[model samples]
Target: MPSNPTLLDDQPATGAPPSSPSATTIGDLEAGLDRLQSQGPPARRDLVRSLLPVAAVVALLCVWQILSWAGLKRSDLLPGPLTVAASLADAFADGTLQRAVATSLLRGVSGFAIAILIATPLALLLAQVRTLRAALGPLVSGLQVLPSVAWVPAAIIWFGLTDATVYFVVLMGATPSIVNGLLSGIDQIPPQYRSVGTVLGATRLQHTLLITLPAALPAYLGGLKQGWAFSWRSLMAAEIIAVGGSIGFGLGSMLQQGRDLSSMPLVMAAILAILVVGIVIELLVFSPLERRLLRRRGLLTQGAS
Candidate 1:
């Protein structure tokens, strides 16, 4: 509970529009959100901690090699790590890997950007409008859990082997995530913050943008990360299902080609390329952003590993 709490009842009688929320009240709301936060950042990770992921990858490779030697499947069907590595090297030297990665990344980023543009205002409108929220809230929430690949048939039917088809799938997968995240942030805000904003005579827009929105930052960040994941997954699915010579080949296309050729090494390399791209973005982009946000808000106490 807040000390010297401000509630609707505590506000002085007013006639004009509410003013902006006080900085103190905003600060208090931030603190309250922290209290309600169910998760916290893990302990500080350093050089050794970073190496853990590399070590895990090495261990998995060893296991894969052992499985190959144990003859779980014919060598032709299940290539060893060295074979896959060689295939990856060949793709890299020929520039196929680079082009495939670039194409896939472009699609994923474009879709995610479009999703943010659509979702931001949609979420804000829904958050503020009681009737709209009541009607569509559950539907929107459900959309986040719906598999991105399920949209492929409809997208293909409508847009037909074009970039538009791929974009539609990405939009379907990512928008729910971004909207839900923003709404969740808005919901997590303490009512007292609104009361204080009212007492200060802030307009609805001002209160929402300045108070509710800023207070919702942590939740918004999580949603943004999920949106990226959804977009990436959707893009790969679209690329696989909507393969066209007109549309430049992507990483997923590489995988399909490998399958068609019955080359396990190429297939494994393509799979790893997809996984590595996602991991790289998460590690280099989202993780750093998250850590910075937590640290800036005085919510994280990271010690050197």
Candidate 2:
């Protein structure tokens, strides 16, 4: 008989059969690698975006140094970047800068914390009680616009020329902003969310803590940030006016002393120190916090990256 074709040979070929397990796994890994490769450029772009500002700052310092070398401005008035840097180094070596920074930071942070502690509960209470809100709302809003420096006189009267006076001024400046911010956040919360909470058997406290607090956190944090700024400014103003034998040496005191001595570089140094501290705190603390909260809520955009 003629040789019979085996079943395998007799079957008409459509195409390659399904891959073996090893081949399939290899193909999957290749696809995954391709996907990752495609995603790499965007990550790099984001990194560049984050680094661009730092590069710009470095460039600015270079420009400033060049201008200083060329004597573009009076050293006494404009004070070359190098001179400022030297002054900063000197201050650090003398231990004056560290002590001043610590004193100012302590006053600002302590007062800010106290303000938040006072304002948060008050905001919650006002948010829940219509009567309390109606009674206090106008006052709180008005207080936000009042200059913190105005409180210095009253604080001095109430607490004298001690640290307590400085703390009082900071509290007055920060508390209103915090309370108003929290209240505004609460007000913006949708009634639908409250209804849903009620339907889900959430008690008043549970609803406030779990649902309302989380929902209002962004605004609350914003208020807290603003409050901190106000507290810092207020504390500085208070220190400038109230510094005496009893009050510790602070950045504001340094500025005052520089003015007394007519040392422009020292005055500028104190101002620069204040500015740097504010920026560092905002960048290291509040900015990250805001970014994290906003990202979790999907409110932050790619541009924000």
Candidate 3:
């Protein structure tokens, strides 16, 4: 049958017109989402964030100085910032503090490096093997809670007053942390990730390198940070106890010497040096790396850590 032209014209269009409000609304929604996903905080906000910590430190120093001024009778016991700074300068000029820092950093970094090497593979094995993880998992967690200082006496007995003793202590302190961190990261992975990898015929190594490791990076980094802390603490404990050993004078030994000489400024200087080193490392290395990683993942929000 022939359709009338008016009847055909009266039929409604199947789709919205190109310039319709609904189309425009959908387009606007998409653009908004894109902007939200891509944009971060402004540069001015970042600058303010960078300055905040420095301001806090300055405030703390001011308070410390004021307290020292008020406590004139106990000035020798609680040396002012100036006294500590002067002691640091003197130690630096005489090469004492420099040597101590160098020795400690070298030992801590090297020992931590070795600990990573030993722990990564061990953790991987335990993570992959059900029986091994079930057997050793509790022990690994327990080790994290154990005081690293507890190992000093045993380390000395096993290795005597040698660098080996210090390294052993550091290993004992750091390895468990790394192991636990990696395992925790791996455990947190959704089971579907493994299933996807398996369906794609990925080898075990490929699965780990491409899928598991990247997913677990944040946790692994956290573990590494904790491991470094444990390494530094263990090294200090060993150095303080085994000062006469071949390990040379480290920050802990420097502290011990200050005590032996009954010099409060030197003691405070040593303590400050240790703190500065820890802070410097965190600010220079881990903090930037963490920010970068988290930003890449879109996990770091503006004005947040």
Candidate 4:
């Protein structure tokens, strides 16, 4: 046969060789594969990390059950998970749990809103004025370290065992955190961003709203989250200790009643409910908001050096 016309010699192999793809096609396939592989690790890691915490909680519950079974602790003093679960079901059936949750959530949200409204302007003022910052910064930072319960005494004195007292305590507990957060966020903003704003002839208000506020959102959000935590804690403390008719039947009051009655199961149920509510608020609202803001600005993954 006439030298068996070589495969490579036949029309330059039309497109790709029989055993190999074109360089561009190979590159595209490699890129796709790399993307797929890259995506797989994060998904697997997230699943594993999520499962690990749940596993640990389950293990702790098992240990608790074992302790109860072994008679290492009195059932009344250290009720097992089953007892607490039963109490939760009973409370739900009686509608007490719903009312308590609603009461606590209302207080938390109201106090948090007031704190944000007050703190935002104060923070802006402090950030822009060195004298104001000097006058207020230390106080704000100091307030962060103070326990929310400490405000209960002063709040009661000023507001006299009313819902206003509880609100006052909550505001005191939360405002410092919000102010400090905004102040620090402003401080941390890059000077270069400010310079760009100045170069663009941005007004003071425009610079703050468009440049500083957006850039410092992460820190501000951080403060808001912490402030909410403080507000919740303060409200609970006030409700539990103040013992006034105006406070209503919040989870904190229920917890206090449980303690007075020596009802371990009820106490446990109240505590669990509080924890669950905090987690739900964070997960449902703040977490998604924070993620959206950070992702939109491409700041979530930006590392500080």
Query: Is candidate 2 or 3 superior in lDDT?
Result: 3
Q: How many residue pairs clash in each candidate at the backbone level?
A: 5, 0, 0, 0
> 18-123, model 1: which lDDT tens digit per residue?
3666688789889999889857655556878778879999999999999999999989899899889999999999999999999999989988999999998999
Pairs clashing within candidate 1: 18-201, 18-202, 19-200, 19-201, 19-202
List model 2 lDDT by residue over 161-232, tens digit each: 899888888998999999988988888888899899999999988998999998899999999999999998
Q: Scored by Cα lDDT, where does model 3 land?
A: 0.88
Tens digit of per-residue lDDT, candidate 4, span 195-237: 9999999999999999999888899999999999899888889
Off by over 4 Å in 4: 1-45, 301-305
TM per model? Answer: 0.82, 0.82, 0.86, 0.82
The local distance difference test score of each candidate is 0.89, 0.86, 0.88, 0.85
lDDT string for model 3 (1-305, tens) is: 01324323434664443343356656877998999899565443467678888999999999999999998668889998999999999999999999999999999999999999999999899989999999999999999899988999998898888999999999999999999999999989888988999999999889989999888888898899999999999998888888795778999999999999989999999989998999998889888898889878887866676
Q: Which pairs clash inside model 2?
A: none
Clashes of 2: 0
User: TM-score of predicted model 4?
Assistant: 0.82
